[model samples]
Target: MTIKELETRTGMTRANIRFYENEGLIAPSRLPNGYRDYSERDVHKLLKIKLLRRLQISLSDIKAIVRGNRLLDEVLEVQLQTLQQAQEDMSLAASVCETMLADHVAFSELNAMQYLMTIETGARERRSDYFEVKGDELPQVHQPWRRFFARFFDMMLYSSLWSASMMLFFNQNPSLQSDASSIIEGFIVLMIMLFVEPVWLHFFGTTPGKALLGLKVESDDGGRLTYGQGVARTWGIIGKGLGYNIPFYNLYRIWKSYRMCSDLETLPWDEDIAYTLKDSKKYRYVTYIGGIALLIFMLYTATAMKLLPPNRGDLTVADFAENYNYYLKYFQMDSDQYYLDDNGQWAEQEQNGSTVYLGIGFSERPVFTYEVVNGTLVAVGFETHIVGEERWVGSNDQYMVLSGLAFANGQKTVGLYSKLSQELVNAIDSHTFESFEFSQDGIQMRADVTYAGYNDFDSGVLIPMDGASSFTYDLLYEIRSNNE
Candidate 1:
């Protein structure tokens, strides 16, 4: 009720409580006599303020937390990180002090090089609490999938060895395989089985997975991993993996996910060794999505799109190595454009609300040949040679294969069968044709040879008639319905 009583309740002096009160971290009311009246809420706020101040949190952050302008966890998270960095610096300084003491060196006798040498040695020996001596170029973090696969490979080997040993020793009895209460067993296993990890790390500077993937776990100074450092690294990795062993089921999963999501490139647990993957490629772009999608893109582009029958068909040599080799290529359509993402997946760029996306069959290649239209891809007439000789596309009638994806009300419509009627197909193909005129009724195909020097006489169907020039409109119901 009073400042004295409030101070007794909060274990803080009246001056500190009043200072917090003035800072608005805690608010108090006045009684009828004009004396300060403290409530239970005020006592609680004062206690929190004292605790936050003791934690070395600035009053500004504490005030924000108290006023609900900031979350306590967010402020505390940033503060904790600052404190952690300070602790690391303190640890390094303490290590340097110990090194000097052990070597019987005095501060007055210390020169720049000798002092610098002490820190360098400290970095190698006590790398867990340090970094930064390695200089400006931080190595790239290994892609997530690389680290995932490496662990997967090593675990597979571990599982195979463990299973084989069990079968050999226990006569393949299923009952002896796993205990009903395996959670406790797993906890014990985590604690006991990984002792040999340090041995492998010491000898090979990596586990089997790291070695197989062309990864090394060496110090920044390029020295072999010390036995103590090996043991620390082993424990760090094991700690990340032990989330499932915590006895409580759901809590264990949450912890496991958090640990696994930690940045793998830096290996926050073990700074003693830097992870290096693929000497040929300094950085690897590994997608968490399936490789099958990319593999399908590659093989389908090569065989189903352009290569099987060996037709250039308006498909350029540049278009078909495809992006499946994991190179991104930009394509601008006349009105709409699309590109392959870094993973070689087709991505459409919205073109002012009128974008066309090609729809190939689940196992099919792109239907229409693509040519650069205003720096983007648009449908182009396909070129082919019959009898192993280059055939005039004007003379040949098979050029209709060049028709591909079209824009239908900002949606993708494939010109495969029923959608391939002259009227519907011209809605899209007309945009790319050198010359085209069509209204709500009769359609006109007018062109003086497409950029590749091929003339179309039968509308946008691209069915060429040799020596036939000028415009021809296809009003045949049979051709339209046959497409259906």
Candidate 2:
């Protein structure tokens, strides 16, 4: 169709139609010959434009309304307001014209008055049509669990009540210097509730905070959370936290956190909603509070523990010393070289691939003894005597304990332990027997031991001993002596 045809249909001049195109109100095609090619769609648009113009809608608003960008209800509401203004302008014009006609004003003056009244009345009827909705009309929904958690957890935990509780717990006990271990335990528990719980609830069946916040967990498929889902989310947190908090393990956690967050964002929501922290509502306040609270709690715990009293009555100074010597004698082990298989099992690097054993056990008070079976000694139990420091170490496949002792000669002793075995006896015998530390229940001693050879004597792995060789291997293990 030609612009002339649109002009004939809408009664708008061709120049006006061209003007509308220049204003970006409409777009008409052009033929190969450069002639304007207006389609039926263009005719419809022009008809709509003429209708809106009759209603006094501005070109910009008419464009938006025609594009279906503005909601129908919204446009109708503006039209209603415009109608009301037009009615008011008509009434005002009738009154002004009546006064001019009755005053017998000069014909020229009356014409001028009539002209001015027409302009003023028309202006009065022209309402400012807004393309946006009124603020009050906007709708809001309940905050998501992630968003809520990002808000309240920090405020509650870091509150005066929580801090005071920690301060009181610490002040009552001396010799309980806040160490890495104690701080970690408290933090792990708190995080399991605050950070981990919400995520777990979303991935699992329910989390306490989510429950309180009326949130529900679901798989990407929208299926209910399975037991396995719960465990994965729960333990995933434990594993991730350990990786982040533990020495070396934490580096892996940090890297995993970043990768997981990035990957989660890109995951197809239609396929899955296993969102990471990044998916939680975009609010930063809750996350900031949680992070700050964690830091404060850690520092406060450490400072409070330092000010607390030692757990002195668990064992006397003398008895502690005797038990210390006994453990130092047996639990230590010597090894030439250790091999860690791809499966994560630790065995002697020899062709036989024998497993090493380093076991330690506690006897009566003043008689602490240990045996090294499998696994290296990481820490002694005596170090934990300060209270809240008696921590355990473990790999995915196994766990270990560190025992404590104070020697009879006023020297402190601590020992490392595992299951009982000849391999452990041999490792103990290979030590150089150098220096030692005291503990309430045992003593810790490190010495150099030469590896005689590898052997398997009912032990998964054994390192043979050549009569008391010296190559100091630091031993760490924990003992929970019933004697205490």
Candidate 3:
């Protein structure tokens, strides 16, 4: 059947059917004539969409309700509760209105009735039946620590095996540098360490860690965790382990926290829908719709790219800078200002008589700042931040990328400084170094050491490095500094 037939059968207009098609409520293939060919599935979907529309559900909300993974019984219970609530609200409103009109109605009582009506109208309509576990649902019956350790052993064993394999493979390919290979190896290991356990549990119901400790992650209501819930939990675990726990990446968590707080302050009462089990089908439908939409989009993109003129792989930074707004929006980067405040212009904000000026970089994740202390080099601070910049290939086309150092007492002069690695000890070429870099990786100082401090080797206190390593601990340096 064509879309017309579907419309006729469903008593929906052709435009409405087409609108549903565009919304991904139903997917119909194109016929040879370039017209939509609707199937039985399309008819059924239209019926469902119509029913859901009558219930005053948004498309996205309908999608979630239809695509949910909750059990059938759970879904029915949630639906029953929602209907009951709606009935009670309607009854309450009717009772209040009758009381106001029939008996003595005070001005204050009218305001209360209006407020109650507003709440009843604005209350969350929960169509999806699924609840996140509370803290008490911690499932402490199984020793989490023991399970973690046992899983750690398994992870270690696999890690060693993978490491050995990598070594052998890279050894055969002598061209691969230790630095590059290590980065790649580290990434792969991190991926495995992060996802392998959760994936294993997702597939086999228990990871080696959980199995060894005789632990199982069950739903709070004693049901198996829905696939979506399991995946969400897995992602949560992955974020905590990789994004928050690592050194440089740990700053991301702080940034996230700040952003979350800011958002709460700005829009504390943003719209939200509570989902219960009955909405599982809606959720499932939405998942299917999303998948179908994505697949169609991918196909369209591939086809369009193939048919159209190939995108110019060449565009210089200067060229992109002409359309800075376009580039900024595309990459979601914010414009950052870099000032030359050499005469301690911004000294009022200096900490401990040390002034720092920060310049936002191309990579928004890292804020680059040079710290000047008491007419000498102090540190360069790279506060790991997320500016939502897109990673581009080749040299930065629009901006000059430089790590500049300026002296506090001397004439307003700024010079470029080479980035120092965490492990590199000796200076590659002798240049008048001024500042140190402070990032999550490590703290690096200038080549020429100025300050002296005692080194307490054993204690975790701040030890003044006299001559411990090539790069002194006091040396302030940052990686990937950008030119304004």
Q: Number of the top candidate by TM-score?
A: 1
Write down the TM-score of every candidate: 0.28, 0.24, 0.27
**Order of quality (lDDT):** 1, 2, 3
Predicted candidate 3 versus true structure: per-residue lDDT over 1-484, tens digit per residue: 9767787889999889878777776788889989878899888878887886776555766666566744435544666677776776566557667767876767766557565654455453433222223543233332223433544554454455455454343222212336766556556665665555546545655555444444455555554555565555555644643352455684565355345434432111111111112122344445444544554454443332222111112222222222222222223232342222332121122436554655434332333354443433343333322122222212111121222111111111211122222122223122222233332122223332232333333332234344433322222234322211
- Candidate 2 regions with alpha-carbon error over 4 angstroms: 1-176, 183-217, 220-228, 241-244, 263-273, 276-484
User: In candidate 2, how many Å is residue 358 off?
Assistant: 48
Tell me how candidate 1 scores on lDDT: 0.49
- Model 1, 1-484: lDDT tens digits are 9999987899988888878777777778888999998999988877888888899999989878877899999998999987887787678788877877888866688665876776678666655446465645435444655566666555444544443444344323222334654554455455444666667767887776656556667766766777788777766666654453565663564345345546433455545556665553433223312333454444333322211212223323244324221111111121324543322234466746654455533211222334344443332333322221122323212122122211111112221222223454454354433434332212222223333324446453344345544433221110110111
Give the per-residue lDDT digits (tens) of candidate 2, residues 294-325: 75676555544322223223344333433332
Worst 10 residues of 2 by lDDT: 393-402
Which wins on TM-score, candidate 1 or candidate 3?
Answer: 1
Q: Model 3 misses residue 344 by how many Å?
A: 37
> At residue 444, what lDDT does model 1 achieve?
24
For all candidates in order, the CA lDDT equals 0.49, 0.44, 0.42
